[model samples]
Structures are given as C-alpha cells and as structure tokens.
Target: MEKEKIDAAQESSPGITRRGFLQTVGIGTLEIAVVGAVAPAVQAETRQRGNLVPLTLKVNGQRHELHVEPRWTLLYVLREKLELTGTKPGCDRGECGACTVLIDDRPRYSCLTLALEADGHEITTVEGLMHGEQLGPVQEAFVQEDGFQCGFCTPGQVVAAEGLLRHTANPDIGEIRTGMSGNLCRCGAYGHIFKAVQRAAILRK
Candidate 1:
C-alpha cells in the first residue's frame, strides 16, 4: 500500500510541477524578448556603420540642407521632409512617371533617384511650375482643356510638358507624344493631355 502511494505521488508530481512549468515559460518569454531586442539593435548597428552623407538639394529655386540615409530616395525626401506632396509616388521602382520631377530642366524619376544624387542640382516639381498665385501657362491650359480626370498624374505631366516647351516651342503631335510618353495616366486622358500641351505651347508663343 505504501509503495503504491509513493509511486502515485512521484508520477503525478514529476509530470508537471508548477515551478518547472513556470520556469520554462519564463525562459521562453525571456528568449523571445531577447531576440526581439537584439534584432533592432543589429539593424541599428548596421545602419550606423553605413555611410551617412550630407545632401543639399536645390528644389523649386530653394536650397534645402538635409541629413539623410544612404537609401533615402528623392521622392521620400521631397514629400516627407520638404513637405512637397505635389509629386505623386505611384511605383516606387520608377516604372511610373507619377513621381517625375525636373532635375537640371530635364525630367527624372524622383523615386528611383537618391537624394544625394540630386545634390548641387536644381530640381523643380509641380509646385514650382507656377510663379506666386499665377498658374503656369501649361497648368492653365490643362484646366481649360480638362486634361486630367483624377489629377494624380497631372503634376508629372505638367512638369514634363513644361520641360518639353522649354525645348520645343511648337512640338507636333508626334513630338508631344514622344516627350510625354514617360508619364502614365490611369484615367486614359491621353488625348486631352496632348491637346492641353499643344494649347500651352500656343499660349507660350
């Protein structure tokens, strides 16, 4: 009888002791916390070891001094840091022209462009297309011609049109189509957009 009682106690007690279960759970929680904390630290260390460079972007005729990460693209810096949300971010990989901006009077993909790469270069966005409250001739032409449906791609299109007009005062349909081909319009307003550019060209002349 005593042997039977002793075996029962041993078996039940050894199966799952409260102290041991608690200890195991505590250890698992600690391990999770330690791993979680260490991962962020590792990421921070890796970023710190990377190059930290200074950048000076001449945007909209204004020079902005910024300290950015090596991977900081121009679109991120422009919209996030400088509060210029006129440039839309459609495809971050530069496949779409929604993030197009003029660098040195030429259209460039801001999302694929690094902020550091635009250093010491003159950059212009849709917001810079106008002088004071007066809309640029192209912008007015777009409004009159109803060049946009959603207006998301309008900024890039207008900026590209401005660049095109700077080079060609009277671009034919083929030239306009070729020049504005980089920008994409989701609303399928390509015809109106082209007509708007033509109207702007005539207004400018």
Candidate 2:
C-alpha cells in the first residue's frame, strides 16, 4: 500500500524522481550558503567605496589635499592622480623596486604603501629630484655613468640612490652594493649603477 502511494506520487510529478528532488534541494541549499557567505563581503566593499576620505599628502615639496579611497595605494595616487609617472609600477608588489620612493628620507616601496599611511609624511619621487630645469645629482650621475638600459626602472633606481646617499654621503663599493641590493636592474646594469652612485657621491660632495 505504501509503495503504491509512492509510485502514484512519482507518476503525478512527471520527471521528478527521488534522486532528482534531493539533488535540486542540495543545489538550492548550497547556493543559499554561498550567497550568505558572500553577501556581507560584497556589502562591506560597497560601503567602503561609498566612504571616501580626505587625504593630505606632501609630495616633492608640494602639498596636495584630495579625497582618496582607503584601499588606494600610494603608487596609484602618484601615477594615476598626481600624474607623477616617474614612479614606475613594476610587479605591483614589493618584490620589484621599480616603485621605490622616499618617505621621511627613507626608501619605501610605494606600491606596498597605503595612501592613508603616507599622510603627513614627506614624500619624494624622481620628478622631485630636479632643480628648475636641471637634473639632480643622482639623475645626472645615472646619465653620465649610463646606469640604465630601457629606463623603465631608472626612476626607482635614482630615488633609491638618492635615499642611500642622504644617510651615507659617501658609500664604498660594498656599501653601495648593499644599499642598492633592494633595487634590481633587469638589464644587468649593476656595474654602471654602482659607478653612478659613486659619481653621485662625488657630485654631492
């Protein structure tokens, strides 16, 4: 009698087997769980986007007051907003020193630094290392020593060299290598780069 009732229900609901019904229920439950897990994250991101905060950044001796998202990186603000393309975006991670900049006279990876974290700090880029129409000593040294090839990484290299020299006015060959170890030259321009740092030291003196 029970089997007959079960068969009758199956016949009434054509194409709906027990297994198919269970599968549908299982899929629906999984989808609900996924939505429940993802909805909060999506809503939080939306809220963050809606809440833009005011930021004050001191760049290359100029002060900029602007609104920026909390998640924005210093690299993006520099290159995209301020049009300081001298800070190259390489690897978009700390691994590549192509986005190096000076924060409080220390070398920092701009790509890894948050725009908010740099608030009220002295920031310097390759473009700031100029005097009117003349290149800074480090930039001139790079040119005179032929320290770059392709020139994509030249900006970061120059900034890093400048920061290195700020603390150590005269770095020996070993100190130069160690100071510049964080920056890389894909063109294998280490020899020229080292020479450039030495030349920059002399020029600064």
Q: Cα lDDT of all candidates, in order? A: 0.90, 0.92
Q: Residues 1-205, candidate 2, lDDT per residue (tens digit)?
A: 9999999998887687665687689889977876878987678768987988999999999999988898889999998789788899998989879999999999999999999999999999999999889999999999999999989889999999999999999899999999999898899999999999999999877
The runs of at least 3 residues in candidate 1 whose Cα sits more than 4 Å from the true structure, single-residue gaps closed, are 1-38, 45-51
Predicted model with the maximum lDDT = 2
Q: What root-mean-square deviation over C-alphas does model 2 reach?
A: 19.0
Clashes of each: 0, 0
TM-scores for every candidate against the unseen true structure: 0.77, 0.77
lDDT of 1 at 35: 86
